[model samples]
Target: MSDTKNKWHAIALVAGILLIAVNLRVPFTSIAPVLPLIQNAFGLSASALGLLTSLPLLAFAAFSPLSASVARRFGIERTLFGALLVISAGILLRSAGSAWALYAGTILIGTGIALANVLLPGLIKRDFSTKMASMTGAYSITMGAAGAVGSAVIVPLTQSWGWPIALSLLVAAPLLALVVWLPQLKKHEHVNLSGPKQAPTVAVWRSPLAWQVTLFMGLNAMPFYVAVGWLPTILMDHGISPEQAGTVHGTLQLTTAIPGLILAATLRRLKDQKLAAATVSLLTASSLIGLIYAPDYAMLWAAFLGFGSGASMMLGLTFIGLRTKNAGDTAALSGMVQCVGYLMAAAGPLLLGQLHDWTGGWTAPLLITAAISVAGAFTGMLAGRNVQLEHAESSSRTSPAIQSANALTAGERKR
Candidate 1:
């Protein structure tokens, strides 16, 4: 009976994590499909519309590093619960029928998402340390699927019920996540209550390995977001109809969810991920090159890009857990990586857009992104080494408790 109860608790925890993942991407992706409805409703300028769309990413950059510190002080479970409330409020406020509310709400939503994004890996590291790869894959799939569903349905919903109503409906996801997540608060209360007192002081920012992981993740994100922002336009420019381009875009997103399962099943069998990392990065670069050289094969290239991006992202997230000695270090490393990674991601689309304007063509921008992807392959090779951040040179300055924890973790791994 006791064993059965523990198994059920683990199942509940996994369900809760996936439910939160469902909220991670939908709030932003859903807005993309209804952007025209929102712009016309607000009578906004093109620049204003762009800013509205970009606000969440900016919020992500600003809020991500702060989440770990906040979680350390307040406890991850409680902090996450608070984040869901913020998201729910942001959704409703965005649908409040005003420009200020719209931007402000987006910031709130982004804040909540950033918190969840940075912390979830740490949570998995704490509770599911032995299954980090599989858990990361599971949540990644959940996020991608939810984002795809939101993108597919939002336009039709907006047409039927109007933009505000359509936007307001997103609140339901976070609310449902909250209900699913409620059990975790009690289950984790004792650990969380003592978390602040027991947390270690590890200088993840000073670790070279941490930066390598950050760059690997950030570089991979650049091409993916670049594709997200420009792929449809590129397709149309290449003479495809808008309807067909949209279908290809949907195909790209749906394909992104596939590699998560693949990695989950296969990653643990490998001694190290260096080859897997290089393969995915090269795949992305090749696909971008394919898009430029063979526009006729856009669908094939898009699917390849999606698989590469998805696998690379899963690996990055898995690295956070695999490279850390404990949950505290995982949170610290995750925060640092995401703070830099997302800032890089936010800049990709804008930089690509500028390059396109300067060159008056998509070829130059796509080529630049392809070159970046090749560079990412090199960084991924370095980041994929079978070494933990606690053993990095800079960790010599970490607190005694951290060093002790690292020693214990190393000893455990040997057995």
Candidate 2:
């Protein structure tokens, strides 16, 4: 009877997590594919349009560290449940009549995501410590799949049900997460909320490895977000219909999503993940070349872009997990990584738009992206090294405990 009850607890935990993961990216990515229609309707400037693409990310960038601190104080269940409700509210507000309401809604949506994002790795760490790689892989795949669906469908929803209704649909997924997760709240309550009591001895922000990881994560994200924010629009510019553009976006997303699952399941945990990092860089470059130089074989370019982009995305998440030793370090490193990383990633869509306006073609942005992929590969190789974040000589991302561990190790060696 006890074993059966434990099994039930595990099912509830997995369901709650998958449900939460589905909501994180939809609101953010769904806005990109519909940008052209939105800009025309609002009579917005390039920067304003950029703001539209970046609003949620900005919210996340500023707020995620707070979420980490709060999780430390409140434990996971209360924070997740309350945040889900906030996300639901935010999604509905986007359907509000005024611009302020829509933006306000986006802010709420972002806060909700921040809470979930901050908690997820810790939850996985706490619950599935033994299966960290597989569980992280599972969550990572769901995240990618949800992003693909969100990006692919927004345009179709606008044509069929209109933008507000289409966006409102995103809220439903999070709301469902709340309902499914409500029952599990009590179970997680008893789980410890406080991270290890020792003061984190090292300053993560000062670490060179931290910046390398942060930049690699950011650059890898740029092409994907740039494509997501503008790919459908770019395709339409080439005379594809709105529906056809959506299909292209969907295809690209599928390419990215499937690779995420495969890499997360199999390739993500390797100590030397630099090879995978290199693969993403090369493929992203090839895809960009095909798209910029050829532009005719849209389908072929999409496949290459998806495969390259997808693997890179999975590696970023996996690298963070694989690099860290405990949940506290994961939380701290993830906070720093995404805070800086998203700020950098937020530029892609907006920059792509400004470049397009200046050059009268997507070539400039495509060329720029090819260069980013190359730089990302070199750094990813460094970050992907087998060393743990805390003990990794001078090359690892910093953590409080890593320095302490180093001191302890050195003292032991001297003795």
> Which candidate has the highest lDDT of all?
1
Q: Which candidate's TM-score is highest?
A: 2
> What TM-score, to 2 decimals, does candidate 2 have?
0.82
lDDT tens digits, residue span 1-415, model 1? 9999999998988998998898888887667555545767889654465566567777899987777778877778878888899999999999999989999998999889988877887799888889987898788778877877776676567768988998899999999989988987874332342245335356778888888899999999989977775676677779976456656676677789898777766989988899999999999999999999999999999899999998898889889888888767887787788778888887777777678667878899899999999999999999999998764445566688988999999999999
Q: Which stretches of candidate 1 lie over 4 Å from their true place?
A: 1-15, 36-53, 72-75, 122-135, 162-164, 179-210, 232-247, 264-272, 293-296, 318-333, 356-361, 385-415
Ten-residue region with minimum lDDT total, candidate 2 = 193-202
Please give, for residues 1-415, the per-residue lDDT of candidate 2 as tens digits. 9999999988988988988888777766667667677667667665566666677777778887777567656658878888899899998997775678777897888888887887887789888999987887778668767777777777777889877788788887887898899876775453443455444433567766667777788888888777767777777777777776767776676677677456654673465888888888788888887887677777788878888887887678767777777766665677777887888777877787787777878778789888888888898888878876554345345467987898899999999
RMSD of each: 7.6, 5.5
Model 1 global lDDT (CA atoms, 0 to 1): 0.82
